[model samples]
Target: MGFATYQLDRTNIASALTGGFASAISVNQNTINLGNQLMFLGVIVLEIPSNVALQRIGPRRWISAQVFIFGVIAALQIFVRNRTGFLLTRSILGLAEAGYIPAAMYTLSTWYTKEALTKRIAVFFFGMFGGSAVSPLLGAGLLKLDGKGGLSGWQWIFLLEGIWSIVASILLISLLPERKLEAPEKTISSDEESVSKSEIWNKATSETISLRIVWKTLTNVYKWPHFLATACVFSTWSPLTTYTPSIIMALGFSRIKANALAAVGSLITLPVIVFFAWLSDTTCKRGLTVMLSIVCYLITLIVLRCLQPHVGKWSRVGLWTAVNGLAVGYHPIHNAWIQVNCKSPAERSIIVMSATAGLMAGTQIFRSDETAEFYPRGLLIMIILAICGLALVALQSCIYYVRNRSNSDSVEEV
Candidate 1:
C-alpha cells in the first residue's frame, strides 16, 4: 500500500506537471526535464545510504518515515510559483523516496527462498504498477476540479495523491513487520554449497550494517553486470513514463482524454507482469525469461519506430500501449535473479540499492527536444541500450552456467 501510494503520487504528478502545472508555473520544457533529472540525482545520491539506515533503524520505521517525508514534500509542490521552487521540491521528494523499493525488496528477500522470490517480487511490483495504472485515471477526474478552491487541476492532483501517500504511510507504520533474520538453509547442489562456504555467506545472518560490508558489496565483481544491465534497460522507461500522456495528446486528444487513455497501457502491464513472473518461476530460467520479455519490448520499439510515420493515430495508440505494457515485464525477474546470486543479506541490500541508482541514471535519457521529432533519437538510443542489456544478461547467465558445471565436476572428482 505504501509503495502503491508513492507510485500513484509519482506518476500522477508527472501527468499533472506536464499539463496544468507547467502552464500555471510558466516553466518551459527544459525546466521540467532538469527538475526530473535533479530528482533522480537526489535519489541516486541517497540510495545506498538510505539502505544502510534501513538496516540500522529497521524497515518499518525507516520505510514509513521515508513515505511520510516524501508525501509531505509532494504536497508542498502545490506552492511552487517558479522553476527554483519546482526543482527544490522535486529534489527533496527524491531524497525522501530514495530507498523505499530496495528496502522493501531486501525485506522480502529475507523471508522467501530463491524459488519463491520472483513471484513475491512480482506481487510487490503489482503495487507499483497498479498505482501507475490508476494514476492517470485518477488524474483525469481530479483535473475536472481545475478552479475549485482556487487550486489548479495539477494542484488538486498533487494534493490528493500526496494525502493518500501520507495515509498509506501511517498504515505502513502500524502494519509493516519488523526485520527478523533467519538461518541459512542447506544447499542441494555443489555450486550452492560452495556459496554457503564463502566467508561472506557465513555472515548472511548478521544484522550489522558496517562500512566494510558496504564497501565489499560495492566492489563485488558479480554485481556490476546486474547494475549495468539494469541501467541500460531501465533508461528506456524514462521517456515512456514522463511523455506518454503528452504523446497521446499530440495525437489530437484533449488533455483529460489523453490522461485517461494513458492508463490503458499501464493497465495492460499488470497482467503481463504477472504472466512473466509465472514464466520465470515455472521455467526456473530467470535470465532467458527476462531476455524474452525484453525481446517483446524491443519488438514493440522497433515496430513503433518503423511504422509510426505510416500509421494512423489509433494505430499509434495501439503501438504505444504495447510498448508501455511490455516496458517493465522483466524487472521483477531480474531483481530476483540478482538477489538469488548474492552471498549475504548485506550484499543484497547494497546491490539492490545500487541497481536502483542505475535506474535513476536513466531518467535523463529523454531530452525535452527529442519530443519534437517524436523521439526518433530517443527510440534509437533505447534500442541500442536494450541490445547491450540483453547481451549482458546472456553473458552473465553463461558465466554462471560454466562456473556451476566446473564446480560440480570438482565435487565429483573429490
Candidate 2:
C-alpha cells in the first residue's frame, strides 16, 4: 500500500510531463500541485473520521477494505479524461487511505508493549520507506509501456501500480487475523499481561465516539508538546519522497534516470533507519536519535545549497542520499515515541491522526509548481525546519530526563 501510494505520487511529475495526461486534461504546470492539494485536503478532512471508523470496524476488515477500495480508485486513474476527473480520483484515494498509517500504528500499539514498540514500528514503516525506495525504479520501467493497448505510459503506471495494490489487498484480507482481544503472548509485561479480560473489554468498549470522547482525545493530544513538535518535524520530510525525483531531474538527469536515481536515497537510508531505531529502543533515547538525523539534514542542506547547478551526477546523488539518510529515521522513531507515551486507544488514535494531518499541512509548502524542479524555497524552509526540529528534540529530551528524574526521586522518597 505504501508502495502504491508512493508510486502514484512519485509518478505524478513524469505522468504530467510525458504520459499525455497534461494534454488530455489541458493541464498547466500547477495541475499536479492542484491534484496534491485536493488529495491531501481529503486526507486531512477524513483522518479523524477514518480512525473512528477503524475502531468500529476491526483493523483487519477496515484496513483491507481501504487497500482494495483505493486500489480500484488508483486503477481508475487510467480512465480519467479531465482535470476534474483526476482531482476527484486523487481525493477519493486520499479518503480511502486517510487513516491507514495511524491505524497501523494503533494496531501495533495494541499488540506490543510500549518498550517493545520502536523496532516493530520501525519494521512497519520499513514498508513505507521500502515502497518509496522501489517505486521510482518500478515506475521508470513501467513508463516503457506507454502507448501499449491504447494507453499512455502514465496510464500503464497507474494501472500496474493499482493491480499490485489489489493483489496486496487480497493477501491482507486473507492472511491477517481478526483483531484479538489481548496482546499476543509475551508482547506485554506480566502486569499488563495480567490485565483482566473484562477490564480490557471495558476499556475497548468505552472508547466509542461521543462529544466528550472527542474533546478529551483532542485535548490530550494537543497538550502534548512533543506530539505537536514531532508532527511539525515530520511535515518537513513527508513530501520529500514524492518530489525528490523532480529535484534530481532539475540537476540535469533525464526523466527515467531521475526516477531511478530517486530510489537510491531511500535504499541507502533503510539500514541506517533500522540501526537508529534499534539504538533508540535499546537506549530509550528516541529524542537523541531523531536529533542526530535532523542535524545531519542541517549540515547536508547547507552544503547542498552552496553547491552550484550542473554539479556531477554522483555529487548530486551523494548530497541527496545524505539528506534522505539523515531525514528518514524520524517516522519510525517519532511514531514509536507517540505510541509509547500514549496509552489510551482513543488518545493514540487522535494523536496519530493529528500528527498525520500536521505532516500533510507541512507539505503545503511543496505545492508550488514553479519550484517543482529545484525547490529553492522548499530547501530554505526545510533548513529552517531542521533547526526548529533540533530545538524541539532538545526540549523533549529535557522533559523526558526531568520526568524520569522526578520519578526516581519519588521512588527513593517512598
lDDT values of the candidates? 0.78, 0.68
Give the least accurate 10-residue stretch of model 1, judged by summed lDDT: 194-203
Clashing pairs in 2: 146-153
Worst 10 residues of 2 by lDDT: 10-19
Name the top TM-score candidate: 1
- Write down the lDDT that model 2 would get: 0.68
Measured against the true structure, the TM-scores of the candidates, in listed sequence, are 0.90, 0.85
lDDT of 2 by residue, 1-414 (tens): 543353454344443354346677776546666676577678767777887788788878888888888878888888888888877887787777777776776676666555555577777777777777777777678778778899877788788888777888888888777653553233455667544544554455346555676687666532365666666666676667656776677677776777788778878778878777777767767777777767766888888766725577679777877787667666677666766665466666666665555556665556555463466667777777778767876776776667667676531100
For the record, the alpha-carbon RMSD of candidate 1 to the native fold, in angstroms, is: 4.3
RMSD list, candidates in order: 4.3, 4.2
lDDT by residue for model 1 (100-179), tens: 78788777765655456656777887898898889888888888889999998899888888988888889999988885
